[model samples]
Target chain A: MSQAAAAPLPPSHREPRTERGRRTHRAILDAAAHEFGTRGYHDTGITHITARAGVALGSFYTWFESKEAVFRALVADLSAQVRDHVGPHVAAAPDGLAAEEAGLAHFLAFARQQKLIYRIIDEAEFVAPDAFRAHYETTAARILTRLQAAAAKGEIRADVSEAHAWAIMGMNVFLGLRYGIWDDSAATTAVAQTANSMLRDGLKP
Target chain B: MSQAAAAPLPPSHREPRTERGRRTHRAILDAAAHEFGTRGYHDTGITHITARAGVALGSFYTWFESKEAVFRALVADLSAQVRDHVGPHVAAAPDGLAAEEAGLAHFLAFARQQKLIYRIIDEAEFVAPDAFRAHYETTAARILTRLQAAAAKGEIRADVSEAHAWAIMGMNVFLGLRYGIWDDSAATTAVAQTANSMLRDGLKP
Candidate 1:
């Protein structure tokens, strides 16, 4: 789980004033994820998002001023969604190391169900560089915090740092890509167990 | 070093047969790496590469048939360059575990010097999906081979599998991006040592 909402949306984006407005805002963002995920940012247009969203053209413009604006919001939205989905699993785990495994397993499941998440986030690298950087930086920071908490409790190594956090994040991201999005032949539970064992014992025989 | 040349140049690429031809071929690839790395594949043109290579347009045609062809070759070349640059260091290390640290330290240095490597290889994710997959698959396979060898020798955990190889690769890749490409403030050896400690001792307190 990460703090995707750490960065606030820019003032350029209009906030919803009513329940109906919020639903419309969310609908457009969901549609944007699908459109941008499938067609890519360069190929996707505002019309494509509006059409898929089943929202009026006026509504998209009501929340987002342009394609770039909505794309940025979509990245943030997806980041938050992953956090929401994975946070509980991590919280449920009994320890810091177990939390890592639980987080990864749930994340893999989420990735499988929402494969578009990868495409949208990966595309953000070129489409919205700032959001892309923020996503990873924020995610790594969260991992570092958890590691520190674990160390405080004497649950893990005492010398954990930002580097360890990034290393774990990298491991989770690639493992998710390979097993979750690319192919689902391997069991997510099994994959997580293998990785967590390494987390537990390194490579010692 | 990885044998980038192990893969045959597709018939589309006209291999150079003479010493001067080989020099010309090498120059064009180096130039393409620069152009594609800087301008990106879509923005880069054959003329841009030739101009940068200080070679005639005819010379480009003598080697690569099209921009896509050259881009494919460039991905392979970069993949090979990383392997070659990092391989000797891994070889010099006394054990499988030490080899990983050596490989990562050298890889960080290579990434710092060849920052475009990340951009080019990343862009290949979209431009040349096959090449991008091949680059990682081959690299992972190499790591898996070493891990299996180490396991056989009882130098590491007996259960080290492809998952472990991918995990280590993921760690190295993100570490390279954060420390190598993004900033040079952190010492490569220090960063590698931190990660290697995790590999050597897990996260146990």
Candidate 2:
């Protein structure tokens, strides 16, 4: 997460208003996503975001304290969707692969809506690490908990230990990265389908 | 990779080099890994690095150029290990899981060695979009080639396609992130062993 929103440059100034303020805030965020998505977080600037958003420098501060703040918000929003998609379905899965696919669906949907945020969370390690690590640990724990619950209920396979559960969670995250977030090439659909199929069938003899 | 490393804030003054220069360079990079592993890329700075390295500001320039330069160098150095490991092995596998596991082992070793880089790569969607996409595409293509080669050899199952190979590759990358990079704590050796077993076996019924 960036403390500054736009890379190293000062975020542009903007006029304040309740409705317009919210609008400007959202625009700045969306622009930040675009910049982060296109130009990259490190390469992007606050000025770039405000310019894209058609806002003033002052307006950025009014909305987000820093790029990191906006980034956190971005991750929080996406995680919320992931949480929505994952929280229940994962708990309901009857097997390891089933659990994984349900969780993957959440991540895929999250990636579609919050590609920027997901990107940040995914890349939090490089740019804003503490925050990213925090998010990952939290998210991993949640998914693990759900898996544990399923295990308890005899829904998730009992043979899959808690630790292996995390690896399964890792698979879910990586699958989303391949299929949803980095699907820019449009050739990943088959990969997604087959991998998902493998997930359902169990990848062994 | 980052362009010429952003020159960090200049030292208050310049200093001459000695044998300590090599030692300090090593120290700086070691410190850099520690810093990057813990703090992330953006939050860390030359000042932080130098402080950790116990070298003066000017010394940073002697070894490398910018924080990003260090990062690139770090990632490059790490890639050497990754390349050495996975780069050569995927070519050797005679069958599906064998090919995947050969690649997976290399990825796991890389993650274990440079956990931060894998974390960053996984998160490239947000932190460094261009680089992440580049790596993703390049890696996918590389795996696709291997799959094609296997196809030529008649080693690949007729059921698996080029895209499925790429998704398998994606699964390997994700496995590294989920188990190796995301804090070795949450998961366990049993989980890894089991997952790796499945990774080699896959969910193919």
Candidate 3:
């Protein structure tokens, strides 16, 4: 467990770098994401990522200590990017459902862009576990806060909270799993429609 | 795929097996379940299962053709048990929200009793994927039909259709994933409440 904690960055002889060094670092991450997207986190090797990035093995060590570190950094970067992409959609919308619909559209588009996240969530069940929940909790928390704002506006259900946030987050994950893994083409539209319906109507049966 | 197409037994293996054979077979299944639950399907070995059961290797092979056969048997047995247990609760509930809530309770109880379903879902994500989708799709079909029934009864929004049905099913899956993998103590109640809220209220602002 301590090792798990140590993984985020841990201690490294790796020097923090300027733009050129950062360029090298970003290259490693981009290459790692591509490799992970294809081979999966568990099946992929550091050598594979380094080789694909066309960087020396020592360069990877300079950026990250373990494969887990590389993965964690990749995930962190992904979250930041997702949040950045989702932020405006949520902010620009006028109402709860509208905001949610817009936010979800952004998420789905982002999900399409980053097959890496899909791969991580998929294989996370086996390989780099806790990453799913860990990735999700942060995402869920932000979503809850956003929904809470709507509740304050008396637009959505005031009672909705973290639990609901997590549940819906799960919905997005499963949607991706179904469509991405199993190649559900039209099903993706069906999923989007469902999410839109829920965002608009809630489950008022 | 052929065996998948093979007509399923009529939800029973009660061909009046001899007591000794039945007992030994049960022991093997129990051991295999535990092995798969703990070590995962891909990671568990036939020897470990046999060792755990205190049965000879020859005996294990006698009862099952291979590890897949053992896993298939266990999954088939557990899937039937879950369907049987959930059948009444799902039937008793008359509306979408009620059905979803009853389902949450039944699903949690089913997972508690069969603890292995959790492992099976997790492991099957990689090892026995078709099995994962088969059970979930079957369960999803049941839920979809129930939701449709509720809609027919005017218990839910008429506009919601098979797509919403799939979302409900997707919601349950995330519930199981969270409860099983994250070790979150608040999960069962949280997801149940969330499901209830989502079904009854939607995320409308």
| Evaluation by lDDT, superior candidate among 2 and 3 | 3
Model 3 regions lying over 4 Å from their true place: A1-17, A187-190, A203-205, B1-22, B113-116, B177-191
Clash totals for all candidate models: 0, 29, 6
Model 2 agreement with the true structure over B1-205: per-residue lDDT tens digits: 1222212222332233677766876787778777876776767888888898888888788777677667655544444556667766766766755666666666666677775676444433344445445555555566666666665666543455544545555556556655566545433334345665655444333
TM-score of chain A of 1: 0.94
TM-score of chain A of 3: 0.80
Q: What is the TM-score of each candidate against the true structure?
A: 0.95, 0.60, 0.83
Model 1 chain B is weakest, by summed lDDT over 10 consecutive residues, at: B1-10
Give the residue spans of candidate 2 off by over 4 A: A1-65, A85-106, A149-156, A162-164, A182-192, B1-77, B86-106, B119-134, B141-157, B178-192, B200-205
Q: Candidate 1 lDDT, tens digit per residue, A119-166? A: 788778777877887888888888999999999999999999989998
Please write out the lDDT profile of model 1 over residues B1-205, one tens digit for every residue.
1246224445558778999999999999999999998888889999999999999999999899899999998898899999999999998899989999999999999999999998898888788777887788788888999999988988898988888988899999999988998777899999999999999889989
Q: Candidate 3 on A101-136: residue-level lDDT in tens?
A: 676666776776676676555565556555544666
Output DockQ, candidate 3: 0.49
- Taking the tens digit of each residue's C-alpha lDDT, what string does model 2 give over A29-134? 6787777766766777788988998899887877777776666565554556567766687568666556666666656666666666555565455556555655
